[model samples]
Target chain A: MTATLTRQAPQHAPDAAATLAASTPSWSRRAKNRAASAAVVAAVALTAVPLALVIWAAVERGSARLDLTLFTHSMRGVVGQGGGLLHALTGTLIITGATAIISIPLGLAAAIYLTEYAGGNKLAAITRRAVDIMVSIPSIVAGLAAYALFSLILGPGTRSGLAGAVALAMIMIPVVVRSSEEVLRLVPADLREAGLALGSPRWRVIRKIVLPTALPGLTAGAVLGVARVIGETAPLLLVAGFTDAMNYNLADGRMATLPVFIYTQWSSKGLDTAAYDQRAWAGALVLMAVVVVLQLAARALPPQIAKLRRNR
Target chain B: MMAAASAVALVLVGVLVFLAVNGGPAVTAGEGELPAHAKNFLALAGPLAFGSLWVAVIALALASLPAVGVALAATIYAPSPRFGRFLGAVLDLLAAVPSVVFGLWGLMVLAPAVVPGYEWAHAHLGWLPFFSGEPSVTGRTVLTAGMVVAVMILPIMAAICRESFALTPPALIEAAYALGATRWEMVRAAVLPVARSGIVAGGMLGLGRALGETMAVAMVLSATPSLISFNVISAENPSTIAAFIASTFPESTGAEVSALIGLGLVLFAISLVVSLVGRRIAKQGGLR
Candidate 1:
């Protein structure tokens, strides 16, 4: 069917070609085309300039303090320059892991129900709108929500990795649901039909056929969610609070994420304080690296996993 | 499955209810130890809300032109489709660059880079209220913060606009060409009409981000805690609701905390309405 459509596609093309050939291009047309091309070039250049400057500036300044200590040592006792981001890095990983644990299943389940079961019901429509609204909730607002909820339950001055994870989870869930729904919608209907035709129940078909096919996309979506919340500073500032020393506990004590660490370093530093600024730049670089790596993995991993599955 | 789906709805309602209940006092009784000269919570809120609006509007205006250009360059005016794809990827990467990093850049690089231009604006454009005041010594004015927010939203706006432009029917474009239209004319006549809804939706989404943006604005603007001024170059600039919440939440207690939360609720409501409207428009335009 696609072959016939492709073969017939060119049948109407000659009329356009004839029209193009008959109309001789005018000077004004050429000038407008030139102007348009210039506009596009200028736009591309303008957009590229800021990005280039950011990456360049990050690498140039961030690398000055990007030593081995940055990955290994914690900024516990060091006053000026010699400490590292080990504490913040570990806290970020733990908090992000907790967020993943909490959000992934909920997001996937929501996506599945929306795509497979809801079927244009009012409930699904409301859930979809809720998700859309959730997507736009500011990171700081999420922080406030988490803070209010946790402070009410745990009492005021409550700051922990768990609270931060919950805040991140709030932001991540909508992203995961939206992206997973898109991926699930892309799965062809015939596959579901085939499974159902074999006398499989709806749940079995979705579980056995649909979920696995969409697994790679789901993973990508989850990773995208992680990439988003991992850099969030405001929410973590409100929920996690800031800690100079390392604290591995999620529920008990304050934790330092890379973003908040950077924030404190810059904001709390005294005038003409170079070392603290250096540390902040290094932390920013590391945070950027983590996000870029996740994005790259998101793009690369799905195809490789598909290839491996095919081979197996 | 049903439980999980309902959780999203529950959280949405929960957040709003929590904010309303906790922040209710500030709205009704003005219970907080108000910022140094403020008479009430409403007085404090008035400036912050307007500041958020003013900066976001400025950011949207500054971002939209470059965003549209980049989107058009990537879709309609690219020398090659592959190059366009590359440009799209670059923009995506830019979007992934965290707000904190942008904040750091705004503080360290852009603030200084814009000093000379800011000085020129203050010196020459002083007749206008928006550019009237002396540029701040540190260059941490609302204008600088607005520019930083503009950079942050550019990628989002461009990506959305590019998707809509790319979806313009090939036949329509060809028809324009056949009618002896120039490339710019083709885009203006064929692409813009089809992409108009998406463009507006994208602009609103960018506006939402600009409004809610906290870390970058907090870092860039030397926030004036309780004052509102229209002077873009002034050191005495108003704080945005999100920035105010972030900066004050750590130190707030009781009524002050409630006031901060009240400000947050306002930010939440504004962003929610803007995003919902944007999403609806995008949906109507067949964009997911």
Candidate 2:
């Protein structure tokens, strides 16, 4: 090692001398570094290309013959004329909202049990593992499972928006549980200790202290879950029967969702093909926009809340 | 608390049980009703499943390469905080985009652009079995699907890797630099090993998504042929299990629906097992 170091030190001096000599002309190093940096930037830009393409396509397909009726009117047979995505929009909202309602409380309760009450008990660990596994189960399988159960229970020929909600609920639960657990865990032991020291009960500490601290993350998780479930078509395809007209009832009959509408239009025949395609694009664009807006809101909330907390 | 946890566990188990009892009977009935069709379908399914997995592995590899590179660049070589933030926001948007949107774009734009390249491959590599399918309208081959899968999974792998890199204490990096390690060497020896498990976890997470993805696969693949081929340009549809169930289930009547449900059950069973294993491996960090 010494011998190698001795040899390297002499070489380093010569290299330093050359660098010093070349340092007078800054253009060469700067150019090289710039080129290298540009390459990295180019690579990152390539990643954005697909996204650019999607945005471009959405705009092109959605706005070429865009109109208000596409959002205002239902998917009635209006010949070649465009109709608004009321059916799909309504279905997506109803199903996703229902899923959120069902999953949030269940996941929150489970997280509370795991983090606050269960500690490291064998059951808690097992539940944690189960939650982890559940998160990985593909949304499609959840849909299928929902189909198997719902169909079996309801009858041979049964499809409803409620089934879609159930399928989405399955997908949402794991994500909410995992995200909520992480957030709850992030609540410092000190905070919990302080709460305990104040003689507050465990449930009170969790409900008041930990949940508020974790609220931002929990909200973010829920928004993400909504985003995920909103685009889901496979499960909806299996469980939620496709409908052309607006259907408010989730418990019975068919309902249309943006995703399933897209799939149906693309797969089915020329029933105002271009118009249907436009609606599909519009639906997708709106869905993506909603998700982006929600995510931004979720991201912005923490800083805004933190600032508010500081001001108080 | 235990009871609630048990409830969560039971929900998952219930899903499996439902599939088993329902799908199992359907599969058995299928063997009797349409044995030949079932055999053909299974033959098709086996290869397609493996092909899909292969596509996923390749896609993951491609996705991880640039993702890791960009992540490293953002962390180490970024010129300024503004640049870093911009890069981060871009990635966030990329991650946030819905999968259906990706599928739609893939079908409309990427597929068309890809078709010509695929034609070239077909013209050149006509001798290959896999590449022997009819020319698709676009480059909607397994390769493209794989590439799309890579893109879809990039954010996840990159995020995990980036976090792991960030977690490596700056002190360790300085120590390596002081010891005369190059930037690349420092990353390899210090950052890479430390983050290896996290990276795998991220990759597995992405793999899970790829295996189970519905819209993307449904939109992208032609999915007509039961025969598997090595040809990348073949227009033959490479169907995934998810695609099969989605397309068939709605139209299925009586036992036919049950049969489709059975196929879905198989898919669920496979995915559930894979996901469970993925979680275990990720938690153990042994794969690193």
* Top candidate, metric lDDT: 1
Candidate 1 TM-score versus the reference = 0.94
Name the runs in model 2 displaced over 4 angstroms: A1-39, A304-312, B1-3, B30-36, B40-44, B124-134, B179-182, B284-288
Give lDDT tens digits, candidate 2, residues A1-312.
Answer: 875774464445657877656544356645664665666567687687877878888888877645777678886775565666788889888888888888988888898898899868888888877786777778888887888788679876778988888888888888888877877776678888999999999889988888887787778777877766777878888889788899988897888988887777666747567766776687777877777787777677556445634554
The candidate scoring highest on TM-score is 1
| TM-score of the first chain of model 2 | 0.85
Regions of model 1 farther than 4 Å from truth? A1-25, A270-272, A301-312
lDDT score of model 2?
0.73
Candidate 1 chain B has its poorest 10 consecutive residues by lDDT at B29-38
Residue by residue across B16-131, what tens digits does model 2's lDDT show? 88878776656446344432155533653576576557666767877876777677766766788777667777777777777777777777778888887777767888678756
- Model 1 chain A poorest ten-residue lDDT run: A303-312
